[model samples]
Target: MLTPSLMHHLSIIPDFRQAWKIKHQLSDILFLTVRAVICGAEGWEEIEDFGHEKLGFLRQYGDFESGVPSHDTLARVMALINAKQLQTAFADWMKACHDATDGAIVAIDGKTLRGSYCRGKDKAAIHMVSAFSTANGVVMGQIKTDEKSNEITAIPELLKLLDLYGCLVTIDAMGCQKKIAHQIRRQGADYLLSVKDNQPKLADAFEAAFPMKVIANYAGDAYTTVEKNRGREESRYHVVSDVSHEFQGLICEWPDLKTVGAVVSFRQEGDEPPDEAVVRYYISFAELTAEQMAKAVRQHWHVENKLHWFLDVAMREDACRIRRGRAAENLGRVHHIALNYLKGETRFKGGIRRKQKKAALSEEYLADVLAV
Candidate 1:
């Protein structure tokens, strides 16, 4: 059963519509939109259609005395709602549902809403930075930026909103900055940041510390895994070493730097000339074994595979064109809520697309999804 407290989160969202002109309850509209989205509703029209068909199921949670609002009403109200309030409520709700564990992997990454750009209006595509808990497979929180390059600043703000104590935060090379590393440590969490040309000196030092010759013979700490997929075989080789002494000068520039690690990948596809190998380096504050570092680095892709990929492929996020006011941003939040609910439902035993189809075909299954 959905508790009153869980429902209260939506109720507390400050309604922007004036009291005298209000025809429908704010909570009712939000509740309807979220439930409809969970059952595969994409836009305002589809959401309105879902509400009309599933009005009976919706009323089980809240009063629908005025009935489902029109698509225009849904769109207008959603556009007016504050995105920050919605994000705060979403983070709070996720925390209530999933108790984050110490030392859990939290992958931080960003995705661009390609369809949000408007040519005539000269609007830019929206970029959102999201924090995903790999352990729970749910988005902890997200924040939006006008440009992808702003993620360096937006990441610290998003981190400030999350309760990340004791979590191992992993970010891509773009996020590897001194301030971001300091912010993560200040939050009482350790960080694993990828290294690339973005930080030229640091990258050069990392390369110097772990030369290919050193990796060929060094046997201090290492982990290797082989994977086969779609007529291709790939092997990943991970190695870690205590480079504090070797790169003492460079370590001083970073925050809480402890160890440097490298990941080398080799792929052979369809008997074609073996593809050239690729190697990447990373820095971490945690004193982890090569296996642990390898696992953390491997698991970081959960944000890409589980959350971003699902949003683009399963939910058609990249195709959405709602760019009015906060409509695009708010709708993105609704999608996250729906994704989290679907992910939490273990009994479905099917992929996300199949579950969405089932929810649309069966009201009982839809109710089961909302019951959480």
Candidate 2:
């Protein structure tokens, strides 16, 4: 089964000697935390209750915490746990789960912990930025914002904690900054960023300057498809050729630019199709090829469809309101860990939450998920 011992056996937790002196061993802590999450524990009190109620099973994983640590103790330890260490350990676990999966697209995006607003009624909500590996469907690293800061300030720090070599990193308009582009290039990875009104001049320039005339005539290998469902429809056309000249403006502005182009997603719904095509623009740092473009473009939604959607629907994270003394940040990590476990399951094809409940009731489900 995916027991605490499995995490102990496979995790990249540090071997510091003082770890043994803690009130609870590392394995027990991880086990209880994982189990508590699996059993629907939302905050510190829920985790404590789950651990206390399952003391016997927890003992099977390792020696018991002298008494289930109080909710505050759990929160204190979680806050004190080095985020970098936990990030490294999470990365190692993902490596074991994602062996031999090359050309995997690892999308990095920031999520705000909506419930983390702590300084009473007047204070701004605490925001945390995270880099999620859309390939393995796991969160690679996360960093919280300092006072008087935003995600733009924290994204670089989070990126530094991850090894992005050989991965295609995708980010939205919030990450369209030139400095962030340079950082991604410096790390030896490619990028596909959505360009929007935030960079008005750049967006206007690209939209006005694309090779519409030449592109229509010189079709080397074009791919087009239309998906119609429910009350909406999406039509996508990918035209890939030499985009180097097209990227000259961006290159002058951001030196990391190798190639760039526009990606247009036209959507229509109800009875009437819109007169003007709704187009979204994109810029890429990767080599332009028809096949490569299609693969990367389609896979980019794994960030939204797989990670964000799961968090909102399956984990019900949006309903959470646990904003007290590290509970918010720590619980978010716990949810990330649980989501990773669920995503790694090979046997289930249904919803993640249902699979989680099945895993809770069935040891085999847990075993397959935790198995290396």
Candidate 3:
């Protein structure tokens, strides 16, 4: 059964439509859009079509006294709605659905909606930074920026909206800023940030601390894993250490710094020479063993593989062209909401694409997904 609190959560999003001219309720339109997107609707027209076809199903959750609105109405309302307000409500709804556990890994990353850009109007594509709960497989929160370069500033804002106490946060090299690290620490959560030439001095220090000669003989705590599939073989080597004593100069610049780690990856494909090995370094505020570090680092890609990949491949996020005002940003939030719903629905034994097809074909299964 759909709970009243769920409807109440959706109702709290501030409606920007004029009160005297309002025809459809804000929650009704939002609820319809979320359900439509979950069932494979890609644009305003498809969403309106879904609403017309599933008006009875939607009426079960929200009042549609005037019936489903037109496609233009849906687009206009979405374009005018406050994206930040909708995002906060979406995050709150996610939190209500799943309570994050302490020590859970929260991966933060950014992706651009390539199709949102408009060359005719000189509008840039929309870039969004999202916080995904690795353990829960749900997006905790997201913030939009004008471009990829703005993620450094937008990440801290995204972090402030989430409940991060006791969680371990991980970000890629682009988010490996001192201010971001401090922000994560201040939120009562630990951080594991990838190191690259973005911070040349820090990267040099980490590389110097884990020299190849030292890695060859002085192994304190090490973990290695190998995998083979489709005639391709890859191996990852992770070594972690307490570097406060040796890298004191570098440690002083970071907040709550505890450990330094390195991951070396080697790969070979079918009928090809072995690829050059790649080495990545990370600094963490948590005291983790090599095994834990390896697991956390590997799990961080869940944002890309699970969230971003699913958005682009299954949901066709990069193909969307909703570039007017805040429509694109708001639609991205709707996608996240639908994605979380589908992810939490584990009764069906298939991937997201299969489940989305099932929802489109059967309203009964769609109800089952929304019930969660």
Candidate 4:
């Protein structure tokens, strides 16, 4: 069969340039950009350079009749493409490429692209909220928000775009809103949302239900996990219980609030005076055992460790300064697309940066990743 359509999915993005004025094809531009980014191009100039170097390989997938577009043309095309359309198209591609979402832990979180801010326009750096399927190590979907405080609103929008039929969605304290919980249910998914000062009464209820005495004495369902890495040791103590009826009056506002839990983490790093202990609280629609709760909560950080960290470290995403029009957001999408491809291309047996270096040096390697 012909290489399946990464081309067809991206081709759906409407070309904004005047039809007759177009020199390089939109499909070519889009394909070239994604491939370039995947192979370690960090900016429009680098993308343009990659096109010049790999024009032969790119031609197999796209019509580069007029050859490569200039850096300016690439920037103009990407900066003007409708971001929402791009998001939907990529999401559809991700679904087709992987079938790992059933019963997965979908973690939703936000990260700020620190370098995208523009003092000239006085616009803040774009904050993107991403939904990641931890089990498969792939980004499911993402949406851009104007600020961190807007995560409460962004999570619902991102949720609407995901296929989470049997997944357990997990969010941090910022996503504890009732509307978010209800929306997750609407998406046919359960949720484990963190509780903090954002919801004072709910926080108070969890605090009361899981007192020191109760955590020390209660012999009910509980689980503990230990970790040791690089002279550092940590233990996670997970304890869960039914959302008591006594808190019904307080937590009634939260939709389908069925379980409440706590994770108390103790850590010691090479006898560095043993850092302060940390405690976190949570509420979930799913009635979870301490073990289930522990797994879901632990998996929730995949978004941070796998997606966001790789973007910042491997892709140097925060260092990119493409802050014009929709360029920053669109470039962010490019990174997500490339990251998914790199993560899914498991035969490479190396991390993202190494894969990028190898892909840059070898056309066969790039072809293998793009083909899959």
Candidate 5:
């Protein structure tokens, strides 16, 4: 994984001549935004301030032009730089991060930046669809929506840009469309999607097909699993049972949904287990035993804990208000880049903002972090 510290060791610029000749080389743009991210910059002006203040150190680092690119220069270059090109380069970075694991769980999710909106715009939101690798702790790439379009369209475009072979792609209810399922399968990947109201017919059918009553009485494929943890006083017991296709209604319309499964889990804390248990239904491509399927389902949450939750709560991404021109899209990419760096760091566990603050305070760490 391209940890912030380790990535600092790599070269950020590949074409020196091209980098030098450009109005603003890619490295200056990349490093500048990285520095701003490290320093808690939320807008182009803040980034400009950061760059002007750190000119000496930045010049020594050797990625900028004659001096640092002015705030206007930075804004213009970012506006002109094709979002697709930057996205491609970002994908390369993500590939490096995912290379550590033979096959990682890459979650595709969307976030709407509520603060990024023009004064009179109709939707008043910028939708960003991103792919995050749980195994490597890196974000693959992100694309922006001009209006309030469905993720169905955005997810496919994002998927088409990525290499999905050997990795399991996880999507929420919004991404449970048939085309997406087919797309994942076509890309040599397996999908584990949540059953919900978005695909109401299919979800209802799957539920009816694998009802609790059917599971309670039937003698079918069954597995019992247990998990124990001491630090948080967590204990879990799961019973995974599968049902045949006999009771399936609309589930039959879904491609390759052979077995309908249910996992009933009970958790305990403090001194006793909770009286109310949690039951989850899953549709799987892999014919995993109930135990294995349960594990994969649980691991899927890492995307929320490791990616979205971190970006929103730790990085304060949704709270940002950089909505002019391509600033919304450009800054979103910067957030992912910083997130990739932080996710790679093994030493920090406090949160992204704090870790970034520490990096800004220590020149050695800052240089060590953004070197590459």
Candidate 6:
């Protein structure tokens, strides 16, 4: 089997410590940290313990020279490492592992690490914006922001780093800016940006085109889908309308605007009548069919349902309270790397939690996960 590319990427991160003062290899500590995080390590102490327990297994892939470092040493060393370089290294590694298929939706969203907040200090929790490739079922890259409102500035920076050619990128209302649209198109990718009251004229145009007060009489393509989940049934009414000549002048500010899409969902609870219909509008550069638009909209949630939700629940990301320096940010990337490795391992027919348990208990299983 070929060696995992992640191992090679770890070497590029610079070591700030003096050469003679360094005890554990920077690469070895990183290698141990990522591997341990994959096998259920939550914090620095757990990672250090994992390193000591799995020293023999880790030695096969990395040289654990001078034995495992203490939890304090690991935390202090990692906190000093540049978080941006760590993000880049893992992104390059993921690029090698997966291919970008056509028509795939690369969903961009932000999540805050709630537990990273320091009560006594002036430190606020850190928020992260991430690009998740639904086709690859793994995070392509992530950028840290100071707060939720910073997503506007962070989205463009994150888009500049990704390989989005021949793909459809989707972002929520927060990312629906003309500059963001231009950048996505400039990268040779199409964008499906949500339209909300933030853009008053654009929202009005969509509302007039697909008015909820009037009966459905759109001239373009349409598709419907129904399903039940979490004790509720939802019927989605999807419509893709061509940009008529009247609104061409209104939407000319947006780059390469092609179609306007809407998903009106009528939902009902158990043994009750359907509640108020929720309608959402989107502007897309791709001339997507109604079915394609529906799939794109649904897949946009993959970043949340698959990435953020899993991190908080399966990985206990919100539960970790280590906020000294950039330790939380560096370890956050390790969580993504570990998730990619676990997700890439398809041979085991089990969930993430089960796979983590298996890897923790068995050396062979851990090796198999790393071999990915």
Clashing pairs in 6: none
For model 6, the superposed segments whose C-alpha errors exceed 4 Å read 1-4, 147-149, 213-215
Task: Give the 10-residue window scoring lowest on summed lDDT in candidate 1.
Answer: 1-10
Task: Write down the TM-score of every candidate.
Answer: 0.96, 0.83, 0.96, 0.96, 0.80, 0.97
Model 2 lDDT tens row, 144-200: 787687778787887786777867788778888888888988987788887889988
Residues 62-152 of candidate 3 have per-residue lDDT tens digits of 8999999999999999999888788887777766777778899999999898999899998898889999999968899998974545888
RMSD of candidate 5 to the truth, in angstroms, is 4.9
lDDT of each: 0.88, 0.68, 0.88, 0.86, 0.68, 0.88
- Compared with the true structure, the alpha-carbon lDDT of candidate 2 equals 0.68
Candidate 4 TM-score over all chains jointly: 0.96
What would the TM-score be for candidate 6 when compared with the true structure?
Answer: 0.97
Q: Candidate 6 lDDT, tens digit per residue, 1-372?
A: 124577787778999999999999999889889888889999888988998898888888877779999999999998999999998887777677677888788999999998899879978899989999998679999989854458999999888778999899999999999999999999999999999999888988877777865326655688999999999999998988779664687666998898888899999999899999899999999998999999999999988889998899999999999898999899888889888888988999998888999999999988888877
Candidate 5 lDDT over residue span 106-220, tens digit each: 7888888877866776537788888877766678877775574778888888888787887777787788788888888788877777767776675666566666676666466
Superposed Cα deviation of residue 309, candidate 3 (Å): 1.1
Query: Lowest-scoring 10 consecutive residues by lDDT in candidate 5?
Result: 4-13
**True-structure RMSD for candidate 1:** 1.5
Flag regions of model 5 displaced more than 4 Å.
1-23, 60-63, 100-103, 146-148, 216-243, 247-259, 263-280, 348-350
Provide the global lDDT of candidate 6 against the true structure: 0.88
Model 3 worst lDDT window (10 residues): 1-10
Which candidate leads the pack in lDDT? 3
Candidate 4 off by > 4 Å: 1-3, 147-149
Model 1: per-residue lDDT, tens digit, 1-372? Answer: 253555677666887878998888998898888888877888999999999998887788878898999999998999989999998888877767777788999999999889989999988888999999999788989999755358988998899889999999999999999999999999999999999999998888877878899887777899999989999998889999887465688777888788899988999998887688899999999998889998999899999999999999999999998999999999999888888888878798998888898999998888787776
* Better TM-score candidate (1, 5): 1
Order candidates by TM-score, high to low. 6, 1, 3, 4, 2, 5
